[model samples]
Target chain A: MIATLLVVLQVVVATAITPLLIGVMRQVRARLEGRIGSGVLQPYRDVRKLLAKEPLRAEGSSIILVAAPLVLLVSSLLVVALVPLVTTANIPAVPNDLFVVVSILLIGTVALALLGLDAGTAFGGMGSSRHMMIAALVEPTVLMSVYALSIPVGSSTLSKIVVARGADVTRVVTPAGLLAVVALVVVVLAETGRLPVDNPSTHLELTMIHESMILESAGRDLAWLEVGSWLRLTALLGLVVNLALPWGLADSMQPLALLVAVVTLGVKLLVAGGVIAAAEVFMAKVRLFKVPELLAGSFVLAFLAVTASYLAG
Target chain B: MNPFRLLKLIARTGRIAEPAPAAPVADTEHPIPKALRGSVQVRHVDTGSCNGCEIEIGAAFGGVYDVERYGARLVASPRHADVLAVTGVVTHNMVEPLLRTVEATPRPRLVVAIGDCAHDCGLFAGAYGVAGPVSDFVDVDLEVPGCPPRPEAIVEALRRVTGR
Candidate 1:
């Protein structure tokens, strides 16, 4: 019963905060660029307006156009429910294993890739192929990095790993932990379509990875895609922050503990998002070809983290 | 540039956006719908302008004007747009593309004609290649009436659409 309550709380918290996180990031970027930004509530307003408009579908487009956004959104929600966020307690019958988490993440990735292809436009096809290539590279790094963290915990479950890390501060400061976290950070940025991998604010279709795919989507469809992607960012970034600073996560079903966990999770995600946006102002998106090199470098770091974890354990 | 230098420049050149003017009085004939009241994604279409209106449109979105503060953003595709910012006169070559772009936008959308050329084909009024004004091609919800509308005028027109 407590586990189910925690899952509900986690989903509610994540859903409420994801748009604000995107808003905060955009505001940070606008400030750094010396402009008066659209207020932090802008994303919520955009989503509301998008929902009220009619979604136009291209002629001959299949049901994939209608379905992909929901799949992406549902997969992200499932990952949020399963991953340790507000609490480390697992919901009965739901696997919070790292592999399960990664597989669920892949479902959203595939859904988005398919959405990109369903439009059949030249840019959509290009974006889909590029998205697939990046996903292929990113999934391995995500798995390897989390596997390294799972080593000392003696289980592949994400909650167990977070709990173990929380219990022993020394473990988090070790070479393996630091390397894996850094590698995870790079992959998170790449996975979330942030700068130095893919620029989220780009208007040029030719330079786009994610935006190009959704160029054909409008109104409610675009809103879902936008919110779905934002939720993915929220879940992944929450995971990264919780892993890096595992304090404040509720281990028991205490009301006060859950409250503290909610506040801390919100703060960590927003602060991390602001820092990322600020960091992006100084960096440019790498060329598409060079992206593989960057991902390959992170893969190497994850590989070393696994090796270091075994030696240290 | 060096990262430290960039940081210093950012600190030095903080907040260049001009203070937003008072919101325009709401239009009764084509008042912004409730859904688009707080946010509107604009997609600019340059049918066949001589580039004057384009320059002003750019300035409206740039740091000094910063129309985005009002929740109006320039998007990449017509599909993503809630507003079509159509500029220049419709030329024979551009008429079809302009019509298609407007058709591509989802319902509950507005089209704002951004210059005299888009309104009545200004200097290109009688050009052999010119098809007509933007209104001849698609429904224009609003108009900004300068030879090349000032950035302020362009921003004001959009603020009316966003009603921010």
Candidate 2:
């Protein structure tokens, strides 16, 4: 029963907060550029409009092509259910492992990218190929970084990470945790198809990575992809903040505490979004050939993080 | 301001055009197959990639590409897709997902390897994390080879699969 309730709550969070995350990013970008931008509710309107339209189907494509969007939407929604959206207590797991959460999201990416290829278009193939390349390089760093943090905490679960943060420490400082945070931030950007890796907004087919894959989808199909994108963005940001800084989360599973956790998560998301937006504005995208260098750097950091964890442990 | 326009302005100042949308999704319905008029379905899976091929894949169904004219459609789940469109290199991290993807597609489905990465390793060859080539994981019948082949190339590959 609790699992069901948490899943429903996750759906609500994914639907309601996803647009806000996009809105916040846009608002930050607009302010940086010294222009008024659309309200935070714009994404919401876009979704509604798309849903009201008819989905266009492609010729010569097989059944995989038609069902891509539904699976993309469904798998993404499932990630929300597994994550600690507002409170950590409601997530019932063997040990509330954070690795499990990360794995679930990774699986969703696989599904979405596959759908892109299923359309059997050149761009879909290109996009899926590019996305896979990125995933291949990035997935290990994620695990290694988490392993770094898990060492100090003595647990691999999301809730355990939170619990570790709450424990009293003399200096509230650890080398492994700090390194893990840096590596994780990079992973988040790469995974989300953001700047310095893959730009979410770029439209050039050659430079495009995420957008190109979904070029065939229209109306409701596109809307779900867009929504899924937002959900993913929010979930990544939330995971980082919640696990790294769990000061205000509901430890007791009480209603009031859960509300606090929700509000706290929102505030952190805004700040995190702002930081990411600022980074996007300031840094130019590195040359495509140089992406490996960036991934290499992440690999080194993750490797160091693992070493640090082992030493500290 | 229109984000699209703003994007244009930003791109102009930065000397970048927003990535042109991939060739519009082809919506031309397939010439109905005499043997199976409506039994055909497709499923997509990304083994690993940079995403250039993904949009062209989608464009095969949009206003321009009009894939519906060919009578084939995209399915949300593998259980429903008749053909499995596989993209990217098989990566170590993505191995389990790739397996799950193949398993998800319904039986008797043709495995089409799209793009150079799916055919070979494309730009990501020799990476520590990659699981060699996609063929290392699953059997592939059709190979669409290009950094991202043009939408027409994709259509030809599909035609071969459906035998229409």
What would the TM-scores of all predictions be?
0.99, 0.64
* lDDT for each candidate structure: 0.93, 0.69
Off by over 4 Å in 1: none
DockQ of 2: 0.02
Compute the lDDT of residue A2 as modeled in candidate 1: 79
Per-candidate TM-score, chain A: 0.99, 0.92
lDDT, candidate 1, equals: 0.93
Each model's backbone clash number? 0, 108
Q: Candidate 2: lDDT of A85?
A: 62
* Model 1 residue A297 distance off true place after TM-score fit, in angstroms: 0.8
lDDT score, candidate 2: 0.69
